[model samples]
Target: MVERKTIFSYLPHLILLIGIAVVAFPVYVAFVASTWDPATISNGQMPLRPGPHFLENYYQTIFVGTSRTTREPVGGMMFNSLVMALTIAIGKIAISIISAFAIVYFRFPFRMTAFWVIFVTLMLPVEVRIYPTYKIVSDLGLLDSYAGLTIPLIASATATLLFRQFFMTVPDELVEASKIDGAGPMQFFRDTLLPLSITSIAALFVIQFIYGWNQYLWPLLITTRDSMQTIVIGIKKMIVTQDALTEWQIAMATAVLAMLPPVLVVILMQRLFVKGLVETEK
Candidate 1:
């Protein structure tokens, strides 16, 4: 209480409150809208108050979906999203950590050259290489499969860079000590590096999970099969009519449902995520 006496101290809280409102307001509106039917919202006179059909609307959206479009269950879409998010999160961590370790610990021919080549990928967003990615996946016959859905998006230049930089900050004494104890690189990596990297790994998992969950474009592009469609893409199908006929209530419900897992992940890993950001930079 004493620390918060000054107006300066309250300024940060005020700013944060404003930021929270800015972010939460849309979600709140969606929740409100999801509780109402089309006729109630279509007149452009929707109430901020909760409507009576909230449970029914959500039940239909999750289990039955819309009769007008898609009609695929939201439960299935959620499951697909979960699988893709987990796959991408785990895959990126595995790929990035190994790449980071090799780049940091070993001395080989064109080592820095390889690092630079990997780093250069950060300059090229997926949109730029979408065609090439599609071609490769198609040639490999992975389209519409889980591998096709996730493998293409699993590469993360930023994650590799973070791990590599963090690895550099690790004391060389640990490496020497391990070698003196007759521990090989793999042994040291498994025993020491992984233990030390729990925070970083948790933080990356939180981030990459959200990234994978919110992926609309790549999933939409690759997954032609309704059964493989992720929640984010499934939401788009609700608006197929694009007018008042578009079931805003179900769409809003779907949006709210889609937000849950990532929100829960961030909330649970909040401390580790912040710590990882600060530590990895140092």
Candidate 2:
């Protein structure tokens, strides 16, 4: 038998429900607005209830796009976003893990100094370094390319630190046992270390993917061609005009679509992310 809850016990649940509604109200309104005609939303009298044009609005946003301000389809933009996001995530993980492995396993002079220098980068915001980074990317002839979009953002100090901390937790006994079995350091790392690092890699991948996908300023400045535009950056072009003729329905639909990938990533990987975080901290 279950014990009945008193009114005071329900207070916390009530508060949480209220909080969820407060945050979700704007998204609900956007979803509602996306189902209305441009004229309906343009009048600012859009209904609270679901309108009949939801499917058409989404279809146009994905395939046809809001062409008044931008001609590129949202489908292409989403593809570009996915590419950038995955590239950043993979690049960060690859480099960070290697750097951490080198730092933890090898005893080189000035190793701590090198580690500190890399760690110091965490304090610097991307905005602070954008001008120099832009100049370098321009000089390298990488502008308007995927490399320009993802490379400059791939050096992740947080991921490196996380991996370094995790590496320190691996037992010295494992190294001894592997050596006794005639396994080289590289061979041991390939089999033992990588397997143990899976949860951390998954968690970091999610973080870096979100970071790359949501990048607006850098992509906006670097990408001159419409074909290179990311969904986050391209959405701005859709709202350039404040007039009633602007496609609010299409814009709202696109906004909803833009939010789906990151949300789904977190929801799908919730268990892995939690485990990775907890273990990493330990």
By lDDT, the best candidate is 1
- Each prediction's TM-score against the native? 0.90, 0.93
lDDT of 1 by residue, 164-252 (tens): 87788899999999999999999999999999988788888877888899998798889999889999999988886569568899989
Top TM-score hit: 2
lDDT tens digits, residues 169-221, model 2?
A: 89999888989999987998898899998878888887777778899889988
**How many pairs of residues collide in each model?**
0, 0
Model 1: which ten-residue window has the lowest total lDDT? 273-282
TM-score of structure candidate 2: 0.93
Give candidate 2 misplaced runs (Cα > 4 Å).
1-5, 274-282
